[model samples]
Target: MQDAPRTVTFGPKRFCFGRRTYVMGVLNVTRDSFSDGGRYLAFDRAVARAEEMVEEGADIIDVGAESARLEAEKLDPAAELERLLPVIEWIARHLEVAISVDTYKSVVAEAVLQAGAHIINDISGLHEDPEMAGVVARHGAGLVVMHLQGSARQPARQPRYDDVVAEVTAYLQASIQTARQAGVAPDRIMVDPGIGVGKLTEHNLALLRELPRLKALGHPILVGHSRTSVIGNLVDAPIGDRLEGTLGATAALVALGVDVVRVHDVRANVRAARVADAILRGWTPPWPWAFDAVTGEQRRPLRSLRELARQD
Candidate 1:
């Protein structure tokens, strides 16, 4: 396994991996996303949701103007920019958190990055647009090169892979090479296995089970498996009912050393990730609470003898 850099820069922010998993709240500003479409299509609602995610402890707000759902119509760059730029601009001006724009079009990426997006999450894995790498490199913005076997508009009906892990690793490696060739810094790149893009349920399960191999590529790993079909297929739950399953999968991902989890339900996932981080990354008391050794309990301070002794 290659030793990846501990920190990756996104705009003015730097994310330190292995300390605690970062949460990337998903903000799909489109009319046709698989889930939560049209909910925040309005400009006001979109900005409101972005603020809510930041307040809910999201380290990055990923704004996508187009849907990657299979059979979903492709959104042109003009229309996509119309939906995206305003939201990106609003978040950049108002929020202190990093912004990642989810797109594969170089035109859209160029505009959004110019408008203040920190990262370009190319769901196409840098395969569709030849100029995408150049645009991201020029801005020196962070990049997420996701692995999708086929086009997002019409993904393979039955995708096949002999060794899913090895193939994904190879694909991501090539994508990373593309980014490097285009002058995108190694420290500015992340990789996603593209959970629901063109993967089968079993394929998704295998990828999740063997994520350490992907981490071996030496880039921060970002997984957007929240409320996806894999969770639904496994738990037999629909889109709105997959929160518990999503949290369960998130806890597992944290244990496996994922650097960032792109999720829809930021508040619940943030709460779940804190517990997972406490257990896996070694708990640090960021709060003003004392552990009572005798009772084996945590409590707020109220003139405790130990506190007075420490003060002295």
Candidate 2:
């Protein structure tokens, strides 16, 4: 089958895939993010975490003021602004990487975009407020349209699939059209498969495996399975111990050509992506590594080239 169309032609940044995996580090400024709750609630702590991610080679930083886990309540507009405004400014002033604000509220989206955020990573996909489309369009910011099952309260009921993959592709396609109709440009959009919100375990796995299928919708895909119970179940590990599983999934996702990885352990995922990217970077080495038949030994490496030649 033909692969889906792809473009990262958003404003100020063009996200071409296969050059390398783009790592989006998680920075939850709230006290209730399901996985890393309370860890970075303090402003200084959050900023420190963002700095750490940057040092660890994060390509983007995603700041969220509310946890979308379960019936997680939405942050009131004023509090949301109070929490993220300085964080956005701090990152903009200090880090050279892109910043994606994770909010579905129009108010929060507008405020952060004004405060120097480059993208609006909405989990609701413009379903929550019609005005969100306008805010994004006005600022000319990039958006992530995720396939959520439902709001945290309403929640997606079950796998109502006449083929979940096809349905999701259609939904995202229509969403892109909807945003465009409402004035958001096509190039400024990205689609996400909405991993855990309402998908069954099997449904989530299927979406992860077939993420490329969603490409037919014609936008970049951001796969976020980091520290989610999805990885936990895959390895039969608990939340705190799923680091290996998370990195493993990230490895597979990059190999499959997914565009961006939203992750918790930014440094580790960066390593997995770097290795996977070396193989997928479109040029083969003159020869494969030699293998010994006596003990099936592989002569891999004791040394490697570490940095890219500086780009002018």
Candidate 3:
């Protein structure tokens, strides 16, 4: 792990990590995503959902054209471009948030960056497409180099790590070196531990427990644990009922100093993150009137205490 710049600029947006945790809303435009697959396949529906997430306080809209499910079929570059171009163009034209194209194919990544996306979230960590790193570097897009143990086309094999944290840390360190070699600025890079991609429940838990260890790499850490099987297995709850579990885990991650959280339920997770961020980084009232009582006048509780101290 090497020290890198703490801030990254994407288009007009700059993400200054360590100040607060940024929430990235998931916008899957695929028909077979593990969760919420067909919900936003239509252009109108996808645009509307993106708008809803922006309103719900999403700092980035992660647009995925194909599912990353273990058993899912791989999408051709042309097919992926067709599914993602419209949504990415629309979001870029209509929204004020950063746009992250969740892809690993260099062609797909190049197309999306040309269509106005600001980030390329490569789950393969620059290993899948030989040209992925160059595409991101040429476009100067923010890159998310995630650590996955197996190829994306195949089902994830059960991970066999003697020490999950150490191995993951080493993988990311090497991946970061790869990205830097390909001309990606260190500040433009973020790393994901690939929580449920190739790990068992215990491995996932261990990664979460020692997430801060990855900070040694000096790139911002992005965790996407939303409604993963890790939580489902623990609570014996299905995907639909995992909201509380997701919030619980997100709150813990924020306290642990994670830089970004990718989630499905944007509104609920945004509120949970804000509260947790307030606890980890002290809260500042959004407005002075937030302290005002029901009366028309501003309450002066502290002033009253000062008067009492004078009498004493």
Evaluated with lDDT, which candidate comes out highest?
1
- Candidate RMSDs in Å, in order, are 5.1, 4.8, 7.1
Off by over 4 Å in 3: 1-5, 283-286, 289-312
Task: Report the error of model 3 at residue 227, Å.
Answer: 0.6
* Candidate 3 residue-wise lDDT, 1-312, digit = tens: 222326667765577688678889999998888878889989999999998887777888999987878767689999999989999999899877899999989999988999999999988888788889998999988999898887867636777889999998998898899899999998899999998888999999999999879988888999999999998998899988999999999999888888899999988887798788777776433433324466667554433211221221
Residue-level lDDT tens digits of model 2 in 1-312 = 223334454323446554556788999988778888889889899999998887776777899988887756667889989989999999888866689999889988989998999999988777777788889999988898887767633567664666778877777877788789878878778788888777888888888888878867766678899988788888998889999999999888877777889999988998788777777654232444456758778876422211121110
Name the runs in model 2 displaced over 4 angstroms. 1-14, 152-154, 157-159, 283-312
lDDT of 3 at 274: 75
lDDT of 2 at 261: 92
Candidate number that wins on lDDT, 2 or 3: 3
Per-residue lDDT tens digits of candidate 1, residues 1-312?
Answer: 223338766765667776778899999988888889889999999999998887777888999988888756688899999999999999999877889999989999999999999999999889999999999999999999999887756777889999998999999999999999999999889999999878899999999999998977888899999999999998998999999999999999888888899999998898788789788777454445466779968676555322232221
Residue 202 displacement in candidate 3 (angstroms): 0.5
Ranking of predictions according to lDDT: 1, 3, 2
262 in model 1: Cα distance from truth in Å?
A: 0.6
lDDT of model 1 at residue 84? Answer: 95
